[model samples]
Target: MPHTDTPPSGHATDLALLLTLSTLWGASYTFIRIGVETIPPLTFIAARTLIAATLLLLWMRSRNVRMPRDRRVWMRFGVQALLNSVVPFTLIAWAERSVGASLATILNSTSPVMVFVATAFITRHEPVSLRKLIGVIAGFVGTCLVIGPSALDGLGGQLVPQLAIVAATACYAGAAIYGRSFKGLHPAAPATGSLLVGALVLTPASLLVDHPWALQPSVRSLMALVALAAFSTALAFAIYFRLIQTLGAIGTTAQAYLRVPIGVAIGVVFLGESLPSSAWIGLASVVVGVAAMSMPGSAIQVRRV
Candidate 1:
């Protein structure tokens, strides 16, 4: 199904939307931090996908958009769920148990770089240029700085959790590349379908491992879970679709870097978390790199929906 939105008012409105989307996504790390404190990662992510998927279905229904019934498209959605939601969502939830939201913000902000690497080397689905190459190098150096000696100190400890966040970022990159397969889909379709698939994949494992029925989650955790699913996952997808149409793919990607500072600020203000000086420097590098990668005419715009 398809429909048209009234033309956006102007750049200011677009900017507001950009900020809103960033704020919503930025707050997600903190939500995960709070929720996972009481809810086990598996059960928490399962519930998240369940809530988000249901909301996305309602969103689609409101838009008069019907999900694809093709079995093959659904199978593709299953693979997308594995990459976009199931694995990465679980990894981030598990990682946040030890890693702070600020670090996760910086570490997870490198998806464009990851997407570029995958596209350039493996897929070659898009052209590469000097500017984007520079962006890649800058992001790589920043990622190494964020992950290497100063932060790691050793192989174990926070290092494994940090690496897990990076791995989750990689999974998102893979999802972006594969998402192009749904080129003709209503934006709501892939989002709703993938989330539904994610819920299906995670629910059984969560039941077996966590036995959520026996868990006693606090009010703060439960509220955080609701916020995480409603605002961060579901509402963010709605905003993403709006931006994709109004701002074009490249313009919407500005959120990639913008959310870094926003996420860090949210962590500090709400969660009382802080990052080391080296991580700060790495964060700056990542912001610059992502901005460079997100510039006009990059040919690597990755639409999350």
Candidate 2:
């Protein structure tokens, strides 16, 4: 299929979608942090996927869109689940059990960098441009700045959990690239299917390990889980898969940086947190990086196999 969003207004719409995606996913860390306080990682993520899948399924039905029935498509959905939801979600949830959300956010925000590395050395999905290279570096530096110095204080430490977050980031990169194939389907198809597979994969494990029936979760944790499932996973996945088609993997993954500055700004505006002087500089860098990434010239044509 050809790229759909090519006009100037389309670019604006795509950027707005990127911002919405960033905002939804940016708040996910806090939701996960709160949900995991009482809900075990496996159960937390299993429930998240299940709830999200159900919501997406309903949305599709409302739109009269039927999911694909092919076994091959379902198989690909299984792989996507592992890359995008099952493993990464569980790893981040488990890692957050021991690490702070800020650190995890900074670490996982490297999706664009990872995608670029894969594009350079592994996937070779697109050409390596100096503009994009600079964008990746600038965005990463800005992410670090927006996250503040305190978050990096634990960089070298917490080796295991930190590695988990890095691993999750890599999975996200892989998922973004793989998601390109689903462009043939409605965005909701892959999102719902993958989450369905993820829920199926994790539900049994969650039951065996967490024995959720016996646990008493706090109301706060339950609320957090609901928000994480509905907005972060369901709504965010819809936006993500759509962008994967319109923006290509590397371009869509620019949200990895955009979210940090935006998230920090949210705190300043709504949560009464003070924005440091460095955050202003970080915001400027992030805007430049995202613009470089999403420029019409950067759109890639996939070499279909």
Candidate 3:
């Protein structure tokens, strides 16, 4: 496949999809935080995947889209599900036990940086250039500034949870790269299949560990779980696969850069949270970095000797 150093043009629809995805996923942090307060991580993740799988499967059936019968394809979907949904969801849910939603959102925004590094070093699926390198660096620095130094007060003690979030983001990057294999398949097919696999794996674990049947979850937590599954997992996957097909892995993962600001705004309005002046400045830097990274190489001029 021919590679473009940056995202392709004429992507108004893709850009809209990116924003929609960012909003859906940005709100997920809040949902996860709320749900995890009452629901154990494994149980919460299992419920999320099962609900999302049910919704997506119903949509696929309504659309008359036939499920792929190939066993090999299903196997691939299993891998994608583990990386994209199961692992990351559980890790983030667990991490939220010790971290605030806004902090977790800022940390998880590292997904784009992970995607760039994995593409450049491990997969070699895209060309690595100075522009992208600088963009990634700027985005990371901006994220740090957004979180501010005070957020790091517990860094030494909460290292484990923080590392879990970082690992989860890395899994997301890997899943984005691996997901390109499903390009020829309908977006809904893989989305539904992956969720199904995720649910299958998580159900047993949740039963054994959390024994969700015995616990009494609050109505608020239940509603949060529903929203997380329906919007963040099901609908988000559909948009995600479409973006991967149109934007490729690196471009698709760029939504993470946008998620930080959106997540913070959602927190402020809905959760009565507040951000410092530095966060606004950092958000501006993130926007500039993402814009620079998304531009085509030809759009940036160089003088020849």
Candidate 4:
């Protein structure tokens, strides 16, 4: 499979998608924070995956697309779903129970950096230059700066949940690289197939563990759960696959860095959370790091954001 070409509009579409992805993802923390308060983590995740899978299936059917029956394809889709959705979704949900959404999101922004690091070892196609390595380290350092104060503020710090978020990001990095194989297939096909497998794998476990029927949730919580499934899981992927097709993985993953401000803004506006001075410094560092990392290898220039 060939590498996805850069978007036709050059960097403009990339920037736009970056903004959109960041905003949607940033608000995600707020939504998860609210939903988890009312619903159990596993149950909430189950509902999310199930609803998203159903939605994707219906959308595919509407387009008259046939599901691939090949065992090898199914195997690939299963692995993609486990790495891209099921595992990360469960870990993020569980971690959110213990950590703030903003902090979790900041941790999640490490995906692109992970990709840089992972590709250095695994992928022969992409070159890893010293500048790129510096950018990767800078990106990680910036992410830590953004979360540092909150993470270290109190005793009994949220070390576990923070680690969980990092782990989840790594899963995504692995998925992004692995998904390069899907370049041969239509983006929507693989995305829907993965969602289906994710739903199938999660359903039985969800029933056994969550038994959602047993717990009563308020109207708001129920709405949040539905949104998580429909918007976060389904719509987000729909756009993401399109973006991945339009822009390469590095371009798509760049959205990770942009998501921080959106998450921080959502926290401030909706949750009334305030950012400390250190967080601002962290934000600046992250922005600089991401900008440095994402610049075209030829230019190797940093522009003010």
On lDDT, the candidate that comes out on top is 2
| Candidate number achieving the greatest TM-score relative to the actual structure | 2
Q: TM-score order of candidates, best first?
A: 2, 3, 4, 1
RMSD to native, candidate 4: 4.7
The clash count of every prediction, one per candidate, is 0, 0, 0, 0
Q: Candidate 1: where are CA atoms >4 Å away? A: 1-19, 136-156, 239-256, 267-288, 298-305
The regions of model 4 sitting more than 4 angstroms off are: 1-10, 64-66, 129-131, 144-148, 154-158, 278-284, 295-305
What is each predicted model's overall lDDT from 0 to 1?
0.74, 0.88, 0.82, 0.71
lDDT of 2 by residue, 1-305 (tens): 32223223378889999999999999998899999989998999999999999999999888787888999999999999999999999999999988887788889989999898888778786666767878888898888887788888888788999999999999999999999888668788888999999999999999888899999999999999999999999999988998888888888999999988777877888889887668888888888998878777744433333
Cα TM-score per model: 0.79, 0.93, 0.90, 0.83
Error of 2 at 267 (Å): 2.0
Instruction: Give the candidates in order of lDDT, highest first.
Output: 2, 3, 1, 4
RMSD of candidates 1 onward, in order? 5.0, 3.6, 4.6, 4.7
- Of models 3 and 4, which has the larger TM-score? 3
lDDT of 1 by residue, 216-299 (tens): 999999999999999998888666655555554434545656676566566567769675466667667756665565454545
Clashing pairs in 4: none
RMSD of 1: 5.0
